[model samples]
Target: MNLDREVIKALAPTGVLRASINLGNPILANTSKSTGEPEGVSIDLARAFAQHLGVDVELVVFDAAGRSVQAVASEQADIGFFAIDPVRGAEIAFSAAYVLIEGSYLVREESPLLHNDEVDRDGCLVAVGKGSAYDLFLTRELKHAHIVRAPTSPTVVQTFLEQELDVAAGVKQQLESDCRKHAGLRLLPGRFMVIRQAMGVPKTRGAGAARALHAFVEEMKDSGSVADALQRHSIEGASVAPNEA
Candidate 1:
């Protein structure tokens, strides 16, 4: 468990590991209903990273994943947790994913879109959280349906309900929970995309830091820390991501 001093210094230049947590992605992080503080698998992973480096963890919280990415890109945060996306790769160096979450669509009970394939049609308005992995993926892939942007991923379900959108795209678990809380809502049969939840550092952090971060992730996954964190948080609908070669 020996850590390189140079890697730690580069990853946490201020003597503390400032990790950006995205509150928008429920699969990774959310406000604790009891404590109202950020808690979840991502939080655990952040703490683990800092502990391995013998540094204190300072969570830089954001309401959306995009903001977390921006924090890392701007060097405001030493590290961040995010879904691996090509658009974000320009500024952040990503480690192998430690968790895999599903992206799915939700529709009103009476909506005729019974399947994922049926969602891409003219006259259908799809609501998605702006800057979410689903939004980015759908933006590039969807050819017909118009995408309506919501403020954040956690609010996409509400946006769908409020706007009466033909479809809503977001984390599968969040959508499922929303469907349970509200009537006349239903999730599609299968997922549209698989979100690879990974750790990231600013590209300016250097190749050594990136390699160290990547190694840290591999060790966490190999040691079962990622799986344990998911279980500790009582998270469902997500599994530990496979080790990268």
Candidate 2:
């Protein structure tokens, strides 16, 4: 593989790759309790990309997807991992996803909501991480329910419990973990959406960097690096995304 110095410089102007890590999504990243470093599939991918570039990585950590998106949009971080969303696409050039994760809802066991389709009824208060893909999707698709924005996806379950929300929408793995941690919480039978987890660079980084990042993701997917990262990180409920045309 040939390195494009011009594209590398555009994407990593600081001479090092700055990757924004969103700790709010446990499926992708979290603070390791023992090492206190960001550890997950996202971190692994970041390091791999830096290695490919023959550069070092600096992780700009945030507690939510919104903040990570803000970091790249403001050029504070050269690149970020994010869900593919049209709203964010306006400011960021997204690669095809290397992983796919399910988005689902969680409710108190005794709640009347028994299915995914039942969550959109009137009087249902859905709690979601602000600026999350689920929040954006629900904002557009929900007809009757009022959405309560939480600080982040990791906190949405706690907010739902505290606020007595009718539903908590987030990554299925996260909701499942919450259910196990706290009794009387149950995930809906099925998923509401499938999140396409992709890496993005600021649109201002130019087309050259965008093309490079896109190819990088596709190569990783095809070479099994993405799947290897997922297994090495002990990730569950995520699978390598299919190659895109």
Candidate 3:
């Protein structure tokens, strides 16, 4: 299956399908060990899309989601795989969601913030990956918490290791990975947001390309290959219902 040929032909000559990584989540990291090749749910899904489309997966690593979306919106990349937000949806064309995510908070086991409701209540210092979906969501939804945006998930994890902030927040998968790296860190039970992860295509691209890609994803979901890929990479908490998308 010559994926590149098919994807290029489908994309037309003017477009380059681009996929970037939001360095905020280990499971979604371009360098994650689970898949042994920057494998994660998003990476596997994107690769599968590329394979099914007969295109080469052009993987781009971005420090944050803001830059990633910009790549898609500016037509630098034809599509992106990441957590979907209503605000981001307004900027780019999003396909039907392929996965569901729960936002979570990470804290040190002994930190006062672990027990103090007031810390989570209002104006508390919470760390987040800068320019990430969590950053946007935190700023918009967490009115009571003062956000300290870290440049990357590692930075956020490092800060949490140092006990410099009360809590760090991001997707549950990321928080779980962080907890593994830092023994003292633990994830809180509640979710901050429920995210529907999807693919983003530039609005500048022809509608047909978006529709084609959407159909390809739908087919992958229907085939059960998507769930197989996620399980192969050991990605937990991502619900893959056959043909659900």
Candidate lDDT scores, in order, read 0.91, 0.92, 0.69
> Counting only residues 3 or more apart in sequence or on different chains, how many pairs clash (N, Cα, C under 3 Å) in candidate 1?
0
- Candidate 1, residue 31: Cα displacement in angstroms equals 1.7
Give residue 43's error in model 1 in angstroms: 0.8
RMSD of each: 1.0, 0.9, 3.7
The digit string of per-residue lDDT tens for model 2 on 1-245 reads 46789888998899999999999898889888999989998898889888887889999999999999999999999999999999999999999998999999999879988999988898999999999989999999999999999999889999999998899999999888889999988888879999999999999989999888888899999999998888888899999999984
Residue 8 of model 2, lDDT score: 84
lDDT of 1 by residue, 8-75 (tens): 89999999999999999888888999988999988998998899889999999999988888999999
Candidate 1: deviation at residue 197, Å? 0.8
- Superposed Cα deviation of residue 156, candidate 1 (Å): 0.7
Give the range where candidate 1 is weakest over 10 consecutive residues by summed lDDT: 1-10
TM-score of 3: 0.82
Better of 2 and 3 by TM-score: 2
lDDT of 2: 0.92
